[model samples]
Target chain A: MLRIPCPYCGVRDQSEFDYGGDATVNYPALDASEQEWFEAVYLRDDPKGPHTELWRHARGCRMWIIVERNTVTHEITGARPANPAHAEVLKRDFELETT
Target chain B: MGRYSAWEIIKQGLTGNKGWERAWRDPEPKARYDAIVVGGGGHGLATAYYLAKEHGIRNVAVLEKGWLGGGNAGRNTTIVRSNYMIPGNTEFYEFSLKIWENLSQDLNYNVMMSQRGQIVLFHSPAGRDAAARRLNIMRLNGIDGELLDREQVMKMVPHLDYSENARFHILGAAYQPRAGTARHDAVNWGFARAADQLGVDIIQNCEVTGFLHDATGAAIGVQTTRGEIRAGKIGVAVAGHSNRVAQMAGVGRLPIEAHALQAFVSEAVKPHLDYVIAFGGIGHFYISQSDKGGMVYGGDLDMYNNYAQRGMLPVVHDVHECVMQVMPSLGRARLLRSWGGIMDMSMDGSPIIDKSPVEGLYLNCGWCYGGFKATPASGFCFAHLIAKDEPHPAGAGLRLDRFRHGAMIDEKGAGATAWHH
Candidate 1:
């Protein structure tokens, strides 16, 4: 089972969470064309390195979270609520761990 | 209820001789086979039969430790869909869908292949986006997948819980017109008969004890519970027991998890479910009513990893509750039976069909719960690999080395939830 680290509820089984795709996907501007909209949603780098993705704790307290995971080993190096400060802390932790 | 003795069903249906023995109780394995296929499930028998019929490789033996198809093949909820996102997987599964289209005619057996259509419901905007992207990709790959609107989805199944307060109100669904279900047993029996007719020995009770390696450290034969069977080529079609079998060949650990996936059947009713109902938000619960009027349904893999065939009470309770929530009419229906099967969930939640690092030992497994759907194509592709000593174009990326080479074809982006396939 996918072990998702719920930012609010701590680590839990993936059965409790719904996977949101790449975390960097921002809603396009109101006048965006179909091509740009498609690129924003459909196109992804999907690199084989560290990736920041979104996950929702559906079965628990419904909250979207950012999970920094390794595509190779499937290890969650860091995770936090989809908040700026939380993301900053995660980024710092990741940097410290990598270095 | 879905509880009927196999004897009662087969008593007057059809039969001259009760074909295919339960070989687990018998002894004596034959030596010198033209082809020795491991894992005597539907795929193994189908491959053996196809080899004799299509390629004329007649001297074959299907080695099985237990009753044929008693593994994941028998335990799967019998869903067949070729609606894939990736080009390679989509193309390969389309070929399998073709075989499924004419399978009953080709096998001359009643597989009960019902193209009743399968609807995958999306509850959230993210889910809808994913479904739309998948539909677009499927269309690009020449597959008939459509994004159905709320009205269309309601028209297909009116009894679904569409009220706004429900979990994530059903946004819409991705429907595949051709995707359907089949009788799992018929698939196994059909292949077994065909293989038996074409001089392929069905060796049951023959557990592979160890791999017999040549002087150059290549697999030349396998020592079985009965005896040693030497063959020019060997195919491991085992699914859940993939890691154990791979170890016998001195292969590295597979990036696969063994998880128990459970399925339940409800009491017979005046068939309420017309098509397969799969919820993307509701724990991957896919339910379809069988021809017998029993609700044959399944939920996600059990949270823990174990080989236990029995399921926990909470999982069954959750499934029953979820099924009730999906179709309120099924609330009073009694769950007649529930069972679990070990799934060989690959790291990418896709199958692996590769010539292993060990020479002469080929793999055709990691199918998770998709063995029944890919039976014909798996046999076709795996036979090609074993016969030609190379990967078929369809199964090229399925190589075991793809993990090391950084080329993974994850059908579902369950890369993190990979273990739950």
Candidate 2:
């Protein structure tokens, strides 16, 4: 079973989760041609290596998550919300709590 | 005594009554049993029932952690077929199909075993070749199977948008006439009641903690939530949680991983699909329109192993994309609901029904979403192994060492491409 990390319920068994395939698909613009729209929606590149896929927490919190997984080893490297693109790099001050 | 009909028993089994709840709250078995089968799903209960009905072993007990059929059996899409690619698998599953035919009458329950036919579409030439090999094997094994052209398939499933412009190009398919989906919970309840009537004790909400062993390294009894109970033999029919149960027995250390598989249903609409369809190029998206006028579908599992219930959006989207491609009109159908269930995926994508090194301990696991189809045959084979202390001819080659000996019966060729295929 996949170790799916639910944003609300933390981590749980894959039995309680659903899988979403390739996460890089983008909808075509409104002004695009019919062929372009078809290509955008129907075409897909099923990668065999480390790919960012989509997942849902069916049993726990109902949140959409983007899971970066190695399809070969069934190892999940990272996870985040279903963001289409990365945010701009920003500089931030690091705070450390030394307890 | 008011004789309860099969429907009444099924209703009580699915929607537990007040008595059912009270009995489950404090379940206590008889003083002793000749055999104890863990996991009161289809296989466990079927084994218990068959042992009492066929083998005359009435002193049997079926232990369930939760309600009957609440596990994978309830969660399965309930597609039953024996059109396997190998002779051994094909023969075994064909036997299961026969049992499925007479199952309703035998159990005195209305299982609704619909033989609406099942077809697997192939998009690529490689897939076509593989399907051809499987079809040939099925035919050789005396199974009712055939290869249909694209036109034939389109005529059979009229709503299928098989135009060349479809997302996945129109291709021929392998059709099996005997394969069909059935009511999942009814089968479980039918077997449960049959076993109950045959003097097999059914215990619900009884979680098995560990196994009690004798000095000779033999499993004497089980440690459960209620108390200790001895048995002459034991069969572990727990599919998804096989590894956990095997670990308790100190055996079954293979490259088996527990994965969560998901299924979704669309809102009830006019019935469109009449047959079960499978897409080979896609992620094994096998689907069928249910009796409720909703498309009941499921696909391969998520890539990781975790006990989380909810699935990711990408899987749902991809699965919907495939469905929409086959029948573009369904693109507007709203998804009614989705659910997930655990599957014990072996490295070879096959099951292991063999006696372990542990004496008196037997295993029938690693089903990988195919357990629902093999319930009857699996139960029969396991019970035979336990009763006669030998493997049945149908399940003789399904040994644990087949993986080590390089004699794997990789039906989907999962061994050749463990990562991708």
Candidate 3:
């Protein structure tokens, strides 16, 4: 099982989380063209190497996080909170714990 | 090899079994062909066979990166069923069922197609009602279906949990006596040998690197590891690595995500489970005893986008949990082997056997985890599409733009979640 290091809940088994899908997608405007909406929502590059994706700690802290992982080897390298403020808080906590 | 028959088998046994030639030739890749099919798995080989047999396009070549049946062909649990309810999916799968009925005879090979039957257990009355609705539709479509009560189900499958205090008590089941399993490897080689007999080339170790397109923006050929090969038409049936091949062909992003689905086979046991069974509650799990006595089974996908032909440990727990939940008697059965197959999950939980945007580039992908059972019809319909340049009636609904058109065949309403189905 994958040991995802959630920024809030630390490392946890993958069963404790849920997949959220491609984090690299940039949703078009609410009034965007139908084609744009279709492309953004349905189409996927589905690369063979490292890509940023989303995962939710559904059973842990229930926080959505961005994860950097490889699709080929499934090697997780880093992760951070989805929200900028939460990421700042996580960085501060790491610095304080180290000091 | 000559015609395979009971007489030939007995004669071969007497003649020291030296009469049989190679099942298929390992011919080198030709410089050109009338049509080229990528991926020599069950679907690809079947497509090549139909192209030669049905369409009379004998100048065909099937290119395989590895040996035949090396991919999902040998990885699946070999469960074949056509219990779909959706309109677009129902006809296509039933057509596949029709093909499976006569596959062994049609191919002149003993595919070992077994019609032992399959049952989907329902735990609650409401679940039974839902299953009843689906069975009603199947009957309406002229397909065989039966709604068995708890008593009948217990008599048929006595090992299921029937106690009143059971966590998920068995109420009844929806069964299709025609649904069963087939030998996966035989399906591949049978199609390969049959296609070869019809004068189609079965080329292995020929990896397609890129597509060669004309200035008019039509695909003319492919650049492969064996060298450049030309073709009047190109069809791709590489299910797992379809998106990668599409990228190399410059088809842009497909509505597919690669995910690994794990399957397991336990050590041989006594022949008890005659019918394939699906767990009704909780996680996705199904099991059926193979002819060799091993219990072939599997659960849901690993719930992530992955190209690795391996799975995580959590699904091991998830599958075993359901196994013990439904059949607690086999708690001590040791797992013999486990493996994974990368599935090309589309936006909708269906397949896409249609023409690509580019001319001469036919796309036969998006079979998802259900491709194993759809092998026969998928190849036939794909062959039709490639030859006629129009979607076959049975496969007309499996278009690439169905999601954009808001016409998804989303059974169980899993929506866009890749792993949910």
Residue ranges of candidate 2 with Cα displaced over 4 Å: A1-99, B1-27, B414-421
| lDDT tens digits, residue span A3-61, model 3 | 89998878998889999888888779899999998888888889899989989888987
What TM-score should be assigned to candidate 2? 0.77
lDDT of candidate 1 at residue B149, scale 0 to 100: 86
Model 2, C-alpha of B263: deviation from truth (Å)? 0.6
- Cα TM-score per model: 0.77, 0.77, 0.96
Off by over 4 Å in 1: A1-99, B1-28, B414-421
DockQ of 1: 0.04
**DockQ by candidate, in order:** 0.04, 0.03, 0.66
Residue B283 lDDT (model 2)? 55
What are the lDDT figures for the candidates, one per model? 0.77, 0.76, 0.89
Relative to the real complex, the DockQ score for model 2 comes to 0.03
Best-to-worst lDDT order = 3, 1, 2
lDDT of 2 by residue, A1-99 (tens): 457776567788776776655577666779988655544443234333576777766666655678887654567888876652321111122231111
Displacement of residue A9 (Cα, Å) in model 1 is: 17
